[model samples]
Target chain A: MTNKRVYNFSAGPSQLPLEVLETARDQMLNYEGSGMSVMEMSHRSSTYQKIFDDTKATLKRLMNIPDNYKILFLHGGATQQFGAVALNLMDKGRADYVVTGNFSKKAAQEAAKFGDVHIAYDGKDNNYTHIPTQDELDIRDDIDYVHICQNNTIYGTEWNYVPDTKGAPLVADMSSDILSRPVDVSRYGVIYAGAQKNMGIAGLGVVIIREDLIKPHKENIQVLAEYDTMADKDSMYNTPPAYAIYVLGLVLKWVEKQGGLEEMEKRNIKKAALLQDYLDQSDFYIYETEKGSRSRMNVAFKTPNKDLDAKFVKESIEAGMTNLKGHRAVGGIRASIYNAMPYEGVEYLLQFMKKFEEENR
Target chain B: MTNKRVYNFSAGPSQLPLEVLETARDQMLNYEGSGMSVMEMSHRSSTYQKIFDDTKATLKRLMNIPDNYKILFLHGGATQQFGAVALNLMDKGRADYVVTGNFSKKAAQEAAKFGDVHIAYDGKDNNYTHIPTQDELDIRDDIDYVHICQNNTIYGTEWNYVPDTKGAPLVADMSSDILSRPVDVSRYGVIYAGAQKNMGIAGLGVVIIREDLIKPHKENIQVLAEYDTMADKDSMYNTPPAYAIYVLGLVLKWVEKQGGLEEMEKRNIKKAALLQDYLDQSDFYIYETEKGSRSRMNVAFKTPNKDLDAKFVKESIEAGMTNLKGHRAVGGIRASIYNAMPYEGVEYLLQFMKKFEEENR
Candidate 1:
């Protein structure tokens, strides 16, 4: 039935597992005999609260999140969290940011709204080709938190190691890389992510924050902006993205069935390497990203000739590949091999690339 | 196929037209020829962008929205907008709020986070049984905007008339009643709805603001909180709730097929009146709300005996009439007849109510 399905490579709002999609489709008509789609279920209803709680519990167990962290399913996406983290956390004074790419820089800019945002290091000169080493981080005592975009989706770079923020708390925007790999949740004060790429669908952001971090502060902050408002009411403080959270639960279960984050990571590594190794060896294709900084989830590449790059993206779509076109900022091609991408998907792309290279050459 | 389908009457996230649900189900596995769920499509892609554009266009044409208004499909629920509206507007340091019921009062409290909020009138003294009159309003020149929750879902009351804002730029939180009736876009400065009620689903909020209202804001505000940022980028500021928006587009299209908002209002009236008239005439039932202020969207009522209310709710579920229990604050039986609630569904509820009252008596 899915033979007509192409290997969708769109960044962020990318592919979900076929299993997740089917489950959602099945539930879309009448979820568990409720005689209504989950879309039509009240967030305040017990049925939806069960789904919400189960989703949080599954994510916690899968990630091995510590008891100290409170999982919050929030709206307004990750970019909104960039500002929210600053509003909620940067109460003391300054915050530090290691700018690796576009999103990180935006995070720093948003954080700067509340207080001083010191750019500890910047990789803009190198076109955000690599993640800065931990030694390069400038942690200060006055800094409330040190923020990092763990993975640069647009630039195709990943931070393989977490940065030590001295005694200060560490915060990471793991939107692209979340759930694809295991992490020591204790290492960060907050690990927030947009659930579209690896987890579920668009519209909702999952925020994992240390319980102590969700304290009362500035009265000027919006009510819904307060973590307590959501925490106290179990994300039903407002109408939650019930459908998004439902689909996320399905994806989280899919990840567990695929042997948890560790196994998914290993599979993702092999899938990424299959395409990366081929691109590295080919003269027709170029992967100019720094070796250590390459993202296992997203691989951006280009041809030596610009017109050939355009031709490759166009022809690739015709040959059962979709969303292979890179972000307009760095126009070339980007293959986002998220956890949902089957290893065979990379193989499909590799064959397409080789055939196109031979014909063009 | 729908023989087993129960009538859902949850306040928000209530009921959707079966046609819309079926269309969404058929397209769940694949959207158009994209070979992936709409959830998987990148918000930036031309494919999803088309969906977004068509949604906005459909809503605008259906509402007869003037060119002066910018319709924003934003993240966060109506609750989030309570704060966002204050941050984006309330520039002059104060906004007047008429405390009609729970949601409007919450909106006033959230707005107060940014600026001073003057309670023009409070309906709590009467348990929000009726909306405060415009003559009771104390709109001041210093007020940035006068806010009102047009329809009270819990209290089962709706403002039968728009408040004379005295040129303070009227802003209405039209969450429950939006799209069930025609709204004169030019009557108010801004009209925002949570979309779960009458529009589509949860996880998305729609704001129709006069174009001039999308102005530059304070540097301290979050980018997504800024209306200009969304209006300039067509609400793709942060990937949006694309799936939610897609579903919303479907709902909007469904509304259009039902002969637009005018026809929807007529149908909703009949649906609400069917239940209300029966309840009003029944010796076992009590419709305590003021006749003039009653909501066509939500009708809250009660029986002479408290235990009977519980018994009726319990039995109604067995008979496939679910979610009929009223909001705890309004503790009795509440029937929310949004546009999606067919007259037959209300008929089923009426039969159940009559049978329950007879047996209990």
Candidate 2:
């Protein structure tokens, strides 16, 4: 209905690259002469298998994933995987968690159901605005794995460096920031991301796990929860989110065309800096999180006046800038600048911010 | 790719209504003036909530779902629900299963992992050619629930009537046959289907559970498996398969435009009958399933000789009639004609069958 496109800044199911959406739109009915939508194609079909294979390969290329690592396109969001991660990895009946924000807290809570989960570090005293230093972590080698959420979507904090797991395997929930930067695949045992942020649509979770980690756990009741079963089937143990995977393939292709992860990181840094730099200079606004730990994906800030913050959000929407309101968990204003968010969108927000601040002040 | 849309008839992840696909393509980038792809919109957004609400309402209307029945858009596919169903319903630690075909047998097998599962009736000994009569099912009030797969997609048989559970609630897996017909919602405790078959696409499973069946069992650990928790969140317990649910909405709208489920059933029956009538008249094609139990959604058959079956499958694909090969479990051919398959597609296959049979015979 609206002719003009808005700059979407919500976390998780946030903005996607327009080019990727266009590609998906073009292939909606007939995918590469298959004469069907990806949703309509059988997972067993060669057409879909190619889509599946190419997607995995593209992801591998973008992330520089090692051959020892298997990329799985599993059906279910990150929350479902919280249980699966524990069921599969917590073979010792104990795991350590570094709680950075909401997602890490949920991961720890879900893991508690399957194993003896220990919070190695908690940032709650700082309101999850900073990642803990290695000295602060009491990671035990006896624990099966050390879990952390690399980027906190809600709190606008990120671990700039991979935490030292003290010989325990590291598992990260990279849900909100998977392809936003380059990562050393060899550094972690498992990296899982729900495909709603900086990936594709919702529903599918991409779990990139080292082959050695896929284990046979007799304690696990559900067959789908068994990582070995899914790994062997190439995540086709059952029907997958075919269309989501296909769209993800398109997004991956888009990422590769945008010069892969290095280029993505560079662009992300620039985008984040453009907004963060402005906020730093504006006495009227505040970016409370530690500057070193600030996320390049999401920037949360607050105006000195609550009424101005409300007015800013309202007026921004009218000017076709949407989802600028911060999450209710920690609210003021948050602008998520995912890879898909163009520089021009940030400028659009900047223009509104300047005009709104001047008029309101 | 191809200008002419080839008829897609693979099992699940099968054909979607063209109207739904067209509507989706049209709105792929901008959804209803929101100025963002539905895929890009957050699950927490008011726009997506409206989509979620309207979709559930449309489904309730099409299915004539009772007020007490809560429809859920769950993350995992039907296979995932197999464990959830057993975990939730098998409160007494035992359940009875009527194994009609592959899916039902799998369900029974999975339920065994959670609790005691007894297969009261099995059709596989007879090549899954017929549904057992009510007397054949050893239904008892002692069991927690009686389970049935209403339609056998692979074996080409269907339960013509709901079996009396003898006071215990009935659970039905209607994956391949949902929306192909209508049923009284009050008869079953839980009815779930993977979206790929008669619904829109893969990744999401739609579960309609009666409120009273949402139990209070402390033993069930995974909060995602808890139906009440998901139903309470409106399937936003975490970010759902948002795009898949959006497509489901478009599909429901298409079904409504086609005069609702009654009209859908009528069209499906007519389409099924066209292929069935032709097969019955042809001596070369073997319709093995008992006529009384034949499915109006899937038609499975074979030629007199295995070599002829091979030839027909190979030549048919060249002629654009694909996925006709039988499941490896059953060596023959299967044509799944869900609600999306147009009458013309079946007629096209009929023409091929007529010509192929005449020439081969």
Candidate 3:
């Protein structure tokens, strides 16, 4: 933790482990003495092939993915998957979506283009204040799949436990909280994440789906937009985001070194608890979401007054804590403590918050 | 040229300037004195916003793209555009495709799934030996657009001049040849290139489309698949590939410092002429394409036997010249001299080929 440097709270496209960034920088020009940048190497070359294989294997190991699942490294963020999911799976049948936040609602709307989309649960009525309770969910028996967002970055709410779909295929957009905890891969039919918040960079998305879920549609779909074609080609039908994949490999290795997902979950909880405990004790600041549903990664909070919230954000930036401002849609302050954020960063923030409270109060 | 360290001849996802790599490496830990990697900075941050703005501006200057043309930095490679173009423009009627190489054929095949697709001209019957002659073109005035691959990386062929489309909009997949030379920007409706070849890395695709071409679609389309939404949002409706865009800016700067597109065209011509002249003069090896239609970037040639082609590829790898093997469809040796390849690399390859020919003969 002593080696930990700056505290970055920017929400997606956030911090990567220092060690991973250092290793990638060293290998940028010459990857493993191949005398070519990973970007310059052919995807089929033994060097790049090994990197690709090892990266996928590492991700599988970290997540405890089943042998029946195929891990795909694809281009276009999770937004593209909204369309891909519709094209591949909808089949003009009914699909249910639990809209906990902005992303899930967007996904539901996109998926609606292909089939009958039912909003089984929506947190928008409550300003996305809490995760949908299991009893609140309205699963349709005729539905093809159930889609949900596991974590909401904008509102700082996360599902505390996976919903039991009673044998319905579960598909989750775990973009913001994927590697931060342990997940049972066998329980879900599909898990997709944009590699920005807890994974690697902004451009690539990681999709881990059951092989059986990608059956070809009866209605002809565009070949490139079909999941089966992409899965069959191992996501190499077209040129992939090679550099992002390479960096993601480094990040997976870093996660393994940090004692894998269980350890990551423990450390993340400790860090979140440190800040949440401080916020709970202080009447000077208010946690934005309900206590039970607060996100471990992104902590959204506000001061008693709007002017003070602005001042806190401004003074925090001046204090070397940048990007602490919240989403424009819900403005206050959001401190995103992603995988790379050390415990000290959170401690520093809590201390500053306490001092600022005393000074302003 | 003496100051140049080594010449790189990779086809796509090829070499980047050493200075750019060095600067990026130095800034991998921190960008613009910010205490975070560019990979870690949020897309919404002013720090990253500047980087994004500068990248778009540099690309515009390098291409002399008109203000009326909206430049979009997208993901999923040029392959995505095969579907995206169909989704955007194929509503009125069919599209005319000129199949000059593998990429154009794939584009046509993908578009066929969406709407009526007609192959106006195909060079496959001639083993892609030459670009189509003006008289051979099947121009259809009623077509929505004309699609052509400006340069065929696999077959080592390039269109020397834009096809005369009397009324229909001209669209080009310039994945292999963009920014290698100047073009009449006003003549084309859209010019898209995958960044791997001449722009930057594999993750980003640069699309320069006329603004009018992005008019709202009358039919239902996935929001993510809509060009108008992407253009209206400045390519940020979803998270983009940030590091790839950063590298593109560096390449754009390098192009500008080298006297822009006019100077680059002269350099490219000289490099192509040096190697093609050697291939023409030598009786021991045969050039794969016709004399007039040879590619200025990828130079494919063949010996009389398959074993010799394998030997050349193996020997060249040992000599620090890599990826010289041609596409498996074309069983021969190909030397891809993209913009990053210094003139001396071509000289080295010629020298090696001459020696190999003498020994084998």
Candidate 4:
């Protein structure tokens, strides 16, 4: 099969590393000479057990996860986690949320169904273009857990630093920017990422949670929604998404080969800077994101008019660039330079932008 | 990659059709000149939407699903349905369950947490060797739904006929033998199948639910777990398992090419008869299951001793027959020939069993 010639820039369910795709393709039919597609292998089989274990271990090594944290591979994306977190953690009283993006807002709204949810900070006033500063947050001391989205995929913004929640555990939905940079995994109570973006696929979500938070799960929570039961069973309390997990293991191996999180951060920084610099140089297109809070993963921008923006996306697609159409809520072009997007793809975009700017100006 | 010279008979995730694997391999990187892997495409993208629609439509056609039943491609496997079924339907009062295999027992156990659950019948006394007879059942008239496993993969037993549930809705977990035979789908209020068996992969579960059953979602149900909400959104409420769904589409197409479920049933019957005939003819192997209730999907047999059973499994593995080990609870050998297992694979297994019997005798 021929490699994808065009670059994909959709926020999540974005691109994957070429090597990861190649390895996955090579092993599609017979993983490790098992004579079965990874999809066909039993989750309890020794072959899949190794794949599952290695994937989790590699994630731990890459993220420097502490011993107290249990990493779980779960189904139903981060959207499902909204209810799970609320169901599991919001027993004492209320939970605090820092709404930064469309997803975070949805999470906060969903949690409201279970308990009293307080919005500690919200970027809605700024049209979600900026992440809230530390001083702007209004976290409550009595809250169960503080929730936040680490990276705002739609608005082109990300948290530069983790919030200090004092005694309360901090839970972050890092759906887009996970493994793109290194972090102190021990500091956060829970960190979750849908595999579509920095990881591999869309079906599986990985959750790294401190053991203490899961202990409360014994108190009348639904069995299917309980983290403790799922974690204890090694995510095999039920039949898991075996193929997704296999592809994730391959992606993790590829991440390790690419020098882990440090190397990814460096490459991601360079790619973001290259594209942002070109956008800054041209006045024809304006970036919707705040200068200080721009996301390295998703870069949202807009032209002077909607028609122009549509033309830009169309012409860019013709020029071997796809999925640059911005989100509907934020009408513009978003160049999501995820870990898999090669720098050359961004360079091509820059060239196209320069030519378009020269002709329009 | 060299194919492992072994025939896998694990219930599920079971063997995949060789042709499906080949087609998937050929289109892994670029799907239909889209310049993107099916994994990379957006769920809402026209290319992927078509695949999604075609898969659902094909499955409906193959199963004879009525327009009133909405087919949803969901994550979290059938285990999630254990809770979802109760949350969606048990609002009226209680549910009737027939405990047969490990999965059904677990499902009944989970459903008990939500509302009043009545075990209409159980096969545990018979070591799950026989399906619950109509005379043995004690279904409640006030029950919201009657739940059963159509085929118990672990014990190699299948329901020879569907239960007459009077007026109550019939819900069956057809995870093990979903597409292997044609059924009157309109008769059941809900039928769910985890994709690993007759469908495609492990990440997605197909739920064919009657529209009326979904309308009465109780208050305070998690949005993700709410059947009505999911069905309303057409299963794209969140980023789905894109790659898994794509593979399911391929498998559905493969099923169509192989002459649909009617043809599949014919092949399954022939294959199952071959293995069962060999077992019935030999004194060295004892078919523990009742003669009339043997599953076409899984065929379980035992030897005189545990050590002999162990030897049989070991020798079978060496002879390129794999995963023939039965469930740990029932110490024996089980050959699971799902929809993907060709008639020739079962023929080889029967020949091997005959030779082993001769040598052991």
Candidate 2 scores a chain A TM-score of 0.98
- For model 1, how does the per-residue alpha-carbon lDDT over A153-217 read when each residue is reduced to its tens digit? 88999999887788789999999999989999999999999888988888888999999888775
TM-score of chain A of each: 0.97, 0.98, 0.96, 0.97
Best by lDDT: 2
RMSD of each: 1.6, 1.2, 2.3, 1.5
Cα lDDT over the full model 3: 0.86
lDDT of 4 by residue, B257-349 (tens): 999999999999999999888788788898978987889999988887788889899998777777889888787889999888888899888
lDDT of 3 by residue, B122-142 (tens): 997899989998888998768
- Score residue A67 of candidate 4 by CA lDDT: 94
Q: Identify the runs in model 3 with alpha carbons over 4 angstroms from their true place.
A: A1-5, A217-220, B1-7
Off by over 4 Å in 2: B217-220
The best candidate by TM-score is: 2
- Choose 1 or 3, whichever is better by lDDT: 1
| Residue B221 error, candidate 4, Å | 2.2
